[model samples]
Target: MTVFVLVSGLFTGPHVWQETAARLTAAGCEVRAVPLGGLGRIDGLDGLDGLDGLDGLDGKVSDPGAVTDLESHISDVVAVIDSVGGARGEEIVLVGHDYGIHPVLGAADRRARSVARIVYLDSGMPQDGVPALAAVPDQLLREQVMLLAAEAGKGAAAELPPPSREEWRLWGSVAGVPDEALDRLTALAEPQPLGTLLQPLRLTGAVTSVPFAGVLCTGSGSSIALVQARVDFGEPAFQALADPRVTFFELSTGHWPMLSSPAELVRTLLDAAAGRGHRLTPANAAGPPAHLRPFPLDVPEAPVERIGRVDLHLPSGDRPRPAVVLVHGGPVPAEARPTPREWPILTGYARYAAGRGMVGVTLDHRLHDVTDYGRAAADVVDAVERVRADPRVDADRIALWFFSGSGPLTASWLAAPPSWLRCLAANYPIMAPLPAWGRLGSAFHPAEAIAHAGDLPVVLVRAGLEVAEIAATVEEFLDAAKEHGANIEVVDVPDGHHTFETVDPTDATREAVRRAVRTVLGHLTA
Candidate 1:
C-alpha cells in the first residue's frame, strides 16, 4: 500500500484534491492532502490588504505580506513526510498540480530517498538554478501574475488570489467540470503565497533519481509539444519536456482533470504510483477531436502542393531501418485544425513504429473535398517516393500502413506494385466508397485491384463496434480479396470502435488497439 501526497496549485487548497484523495483512500491507500503555507489558513492573510471582496475578511487584512515564503511550504511538505516516517516511514507517491510543483520538487529534493515517484499534473518541472518567474517567456502574462499578487497584498510579500468563476473558466480549467467541483473551486480558493513562484529552486540533482511522470491535459495542447515549441522559441523553463525520465500521458480534458474527470485522474495517478508510466509513444498524443496532442517529429515536414505535409519519424540506431509510410484518416472537421499541423491521429503510429526500431513516416494529404480521392491517392504515392529516397531508410524494405479513409488509397499501388514494396497494413479501413462520402471511380474497386495485386501481402483489421455500413464494407472487401486469391490476413478487434485506439477512453479498447498495432507491424515487417 503506497502513501499518496496530494498537493494543489495556486489559490487552491486540499479541497481541490478532495475527489482524487477520496478515490485513493477508498482504494486502500493512505492519503494526505497537504495545503502549503498560507493556504486554507487565515493567519497569513491578516497582514495583507485588499480582502474586502474575498469571502468577507475586510478587517482581517495584513500588511508587509511577508508572512509566508517558499521555505514555509517546503517545511509543510517535509513535516508531512516526517510524520509518516520520512524515508523509512512508507512508500510515498508525491503528486502535484499546476503551481504546486514548486514545493513538491522542493520536498522531493529534501526527501529524495523517501519518495517512490513524483507526478507532475499539468505543471512545469522546476529547472535547477532558475527562478520560476524568470522562466516565463511571456512578459505580459508574467506581469499580470505579479500585478495580481501585488493587488492582493502589501509590501514585497504580494500574493495571487482566487480567480472568479469567469476568470477560472477563461483559464480553461473549468471546462467539463461538474457544478459541485466548480462551485467549491470558486468559493474555497485562497490567495497563494507569491514567494513560491518568485523563489529559485535549489537542487543537488537528487530528485532526478526519483521516478517522474507527466499527466498532460490534451484539451489545450500536448505538454511535450508545447515545451518543445517553447524550447525552439528559446524558453529555458521547458527544457525538461524532452527529458527521457519523465514518461508522458494524456487526459482528454481541461487542465483541472481532478475536477473535470476525477475517476480517470485517480486511475492515472495509481498507475504512476505503481511505477507504470505511460510509454513514450505517439499514442500519448491522443486527445479530444479538435485538440490532439502534438509530438516532436525526427525529420522535417515536406510541403505537398499546399494541400498538406509529410512528417518523418526515425528510430535510434546506426544501421538503416525499414521505413513505414503512415497515412492518417480522411478530412477532419475544419474547427479541429485551428492550425495546419494540428490534424488528429497521424503521429502516434509513427512514434509506435519508431519505438519498434523502425522508421515511421506520417503524411497529411488534402481530403477536405469528398470527391478528391484522386488527389489523396497521389499524395500517398508522393509521400512513399520521398521516404524511399531518404538515406537512413532501407529503400528496398519500405511498407505502408493506411488508416480509415486513407485505406482505399492503397488500390492504385496495390494494382501495380513496385518491386521494392514489401507489404501493406490497413486498420478499420474504408475500402469502398460510401455514397455519403463520395463517388468511387472504376479503378477504386478492391476486388479488381486485389486480383492484379499479384503476390503482395495485405493485412486488414476490422473493428467490432464499428457502424453497420463500415462493417459490411470491410466484410465484403475481405470476401472479395479471398476470392481473388490475394495473399491476405485479417485481424478482428472485438469491442473496438473505428478510432478506438487513438481516442481511447477505456483500458480494454486501448489493449485491443495495441494488439492490432502489434499484429499490423509484425505482418508488415515479416
Candidate 2:
C-alpha cells in the first residue's frame, strides 16, 4: 500500500482534506493529513494577548511564529515520514495544495531519499530563490496582501485571515462547492502564519531528481489567472510545471478539488503517485491557439536597430486583410525576462480579430516606468509601419487596441494617427496619470495628449469595479471627446472587475471584449 501525505493551503487545516483522505484510506492507502504549526491545534501560548488569531486551536504549545518557520514545517513532514516507515527508493508520495506547495517542496528537498513524488494541486510552484510574495507577478496585489495580514493580526504577526463569504463567492471557491462543503471549509479555515510565505525555500537544484505531478483545475478562474501571469512573466514557477520529470493532469472543477471533486481528485492523485499519469504539454496547459500559423516579427529598423518584434497573426486569406495592434497593460515589472510576446489575453484578442477576418499584431515593448510613455508611442508607430509593410496586410486599414495602463499611451496615436489608421480602443484603461498613485509623483499628466485624442474615432470598454478616480477621469475624457464630435463607441461590463477577461472571466465579459474588438475592426474596414 502507498503512503500518501497531504498538505493544505492558507487558512485551511487537515480537515479540509478529510473527504479525500478517507477515500484514499478506503483504497488501502495510508494517509497522513499533516497540519502546519500556528495554523492548527497549537498548544501553550494561546492565552497570550494579540494571539487571538489562534483562538480555535486545542493542542500542545510552543512559540507560534518564532518556532514555526519554514524549517519547522519541513520537520513536521519529515517526522510523519519517519513514523510511517517510509524507506529509500519505495518512498511515499507527498501532495500540496495552494500555498502549501512551498513547505512541501522544502520537505521533499530535505527528505529526498524518502519521497517518491511531489504533487502540486493547482498551487503556485516555488522558484529556487524567489519567495512566495515576490513570486507573485502583480506588485500592487502583493502590497495589498501584506497590508491585510498586518491589519488582521493587530500587528502582532504577519498572518492572513480566512476570506469572508462574499470574497469567496466573488474570487472563486463558491462556484466549485456545495453549500455544506463550503461551510465546513470556511469553518475549519484558520489564519496562516506570514513566515511561511515570507521565507524563501532554499533549494540546491537537487529536488529535480524527484518525480513531480501537477493537477490543474481548468474551471477555476484563480488557476487560469496564476498560470497566465507566470507564463507572461516567465517565472520559473510555471517552468516547474513543465519540467520533464513532472507528469500532470487536468480536472474540470475549481481550486479546492478536494472538496469539489474528491473522487476524481483521488483518482488523479493515485495515478500520479503510481507514476501512471499523462504528460502535460504547453498545448494542454494553455488556452486554444489564436492562429494556425502565426509568424514572429523580426524586422530591422534604422541603424541596424532591430525594432522590438511582435507576433503577426494572419486571418484566412488569398488577399490582404485589415490589421489591429494589441497593446497589453503595464508598468512592466523590471524583473520580467526577455521573452516572446504571446500572453493569452493579448493573443486572445488577436485571435478574435483573426476570426473576424482581420490580421492581428501583438506588440512587445519594455516598460519600466512613466518615462517609457514616449518610447511606447514610438513603438506603436513602428509596429504600424512594420505591419503595413507586410504583403498580407492592407497598409491603408489599421487599428489599435489597448488594455489597462497601456491605454493612456494611445493618446499620441489618437492625436495624430497615420492616414491608414482607422481608430483606437481601450479596456478599463488608466488614461489619466494619478500622481497620487505614487509611482510617478505629480509631474506626469498627459492631459494635453488626451485633449488632442478628440480628433480620432475611439471605443471605450469599462469594467464596473474601478477606483473612483480612474472612473472619473475616463468619464471626463469621454465627455470631452463627445463635445469635440469624435466618433466613439462604448461597451459597458457592469458586473466585471478590472482585467475580468482573465481574473474572473464570465461569458458576459468575454462577449464584451469581442464586441469592443469587432467595433474597432468595423471602424477600420469602414
Candidate 3:
C-alpha cells in the first residue's frame, strides 16, 4: 500500500483536509494529515480516521511558549513520516499545497530514500534560498505582508494573524469555494508563525533525484498551458520542468481544492502517486518561438544602427523626420535568447516605419515581471529622451507604440501627455492587469488613465479573438475612453488572435496593422 502524507498551507491546519482524508481512506489509501507546529489549533478533527493522535491538535501544542519556524514544521512532518510509514516499510507519496510545499520539500530532502514521489498542489516551483513570502502573488500585498511581519517580530509572539473573510482574495482565488467553507476557514484560522514565511527554504539537492508531479488548479488562474507558455520562452528554470519525471494534472477548482472538490482532489492525488498525469511538450516542439514567427505585413528592410540599448531604423534622408518608438511587451524571460529588439515582428514594424519615411526605434526594456513595471516605465522614458535628442529625428513630433503586455506602461503618459508627444498606439495590449496580479495600483491601469488622455490621438489595433482576459481589458479601456470623449480610433481585426501578426496572418490582420500605422503617422506629421 502507498502511504500518503498531506500538508496544508498558510493559516490552515490538518482539519481542513478532513473530507479529503475520509475520501482517500475509502479509496484504500493509508493517509496521514500532518498538524504543523505553531500553525494554530486543529478543530473538527474528531472521528477523522487518519488524524488521530497527531501533534499540536485540540487547540494546543506540546510547548505553547516555544517559537515555531520552518525547521519546526519540517521536523513535525518528518516525525509523522517516520512514525506512520517507516515502521510499516511502505513507499510514501508526499503532497504539499500552497505555502506548505516548503516544509514538504525540506522533509523530502532529508528523507529522500523513503519518499517515492512529491506532488506540488496549486503552488509555485520554489527555488533554493527563497522565502515563502516571495510566492505571494500580489506586489502591494507582499509589501504589506513584509511590513506586518517586521512589526509582528517585535512582539512577544512573532506571528501574523490570518486574513479576514473579505481579504481572502488577497491570498488567492476563491472561485469554487462555498460561503460556509469560507467562513469556517476564517473561523479556524491561526496566526501564522512569521519564520515559516520569512525564513529561507534550504535544500541539499538530494530532492532533485525524486520524481515530481504538479496539480494545477485552473480556476485559481494556473494551468498546464500557462506553464508550457513560460517554458516556450526558453527560460532555463522553466525548461527543467519539461523533464519526463515531472507529470502534471489539472483540477477545475479554486486554490482550496480540498474544500472545493474533495472527491476530485482525492482521485487526482491517486493518479499522481501512480505517475499517470500529463507531460509537458518539450520546448520548441512547435517550429519557433512566437516572437520569431513571420510578421503579417511584407515590407522592405531599412538601414539600422545600434545605439546603446536602442536600435534606430533611420528613414533614407539627412533632414529631420517624424519618429515612432516601438515598445515590446513582456515580463519576458530575462534569459530569452535574441531579446525582444531582434524579434521579427518588432523589427518588421520598425523597418516598415522607416520605409515610410519615418524614423522607427526598437528598444529592450526590463519589464521582466509585473513587479518590474516601474523600472520598465523608466526605461521607456530614457529611450524616448534619447530618440528626441537625435539630430535625424523631429524632436517636437513623435509617437509611441506599445505591444502585448506593455499596455499598462502607457498609463503615466496618457494621464499627463507632454506637449511634444503627438500620438500613442497599442496592438492587442493588456490594458489592465489580470485579476490574478492583485491590485497593482492605478498607475499600471490604462483604463483608468484613458480619461486623462485629453486631445492626444490614440490608435488601438484590437484582436477579436484575443485571450478572454486581455480582450476584457481592451473593452474596458474603450468604454472609458469613449465616456471621456477622448480622441481615439479603433482598428478592428475580426479574425485575429493575440499576437495576431504571427499567429493569424490573415489579410484583415495585415490591413489593420497598416491602418494603425497610417493613423499614427498622420498624427506625427500633422
Local distance difference test values of all predictions, in order? 0.67, 0.67, 0.85
Q: Say which candidate scores most in lDDT.
A: 3
Q: What is the TM-score of each candidate against the true structure?
A: 0.48, 0.59, 0.90
- Tens digit of lDDT per residue, candidate 2, span 1-526? 6878887777776667767877887787767777677775433333433222321223433364374666677677767767666443335888988777887888888778778899988776677876666543434445766886677568554665676654453223344688887876666667666666677788877677799887877554333333444445544445555555777687767778888998999999999988876554453256532221222222121111123576787677559989888886666655664432556566667767777788778877756454566676677667777888888888898888887778667666766666777888888887765422223322223333545654567888998876444676678777767666676788999887667676545678767876887689879788
Between candidates 2 and 3, the lDDT winner: 3
TM-score of 3: 0.90
Query: How many clashing residue pairs appear in each of the predictions shown?
Result: 5, 3, 1
Error of 1 at 232 (Å): 12
Question: What's model 1's TM-score?
Answer: 0.48
In angstroms, the error of model 2 at 486 is 16
How many angstroms is residue 338 displaced in model 1 relative to the true structure, after the best TM-score fit? 26
Best model number under TM-score: 3
Clashing pairs for model 1 are 46-61, 46-62, 47-62, 47-63, 48-62
Off by over 4 Å in 3: 44-62, 86-91, 148-156, 251-253, 261-264
296-335 in candidate 3: lDDT tens per residue?
A: 8888988898887799998897999989999999879898
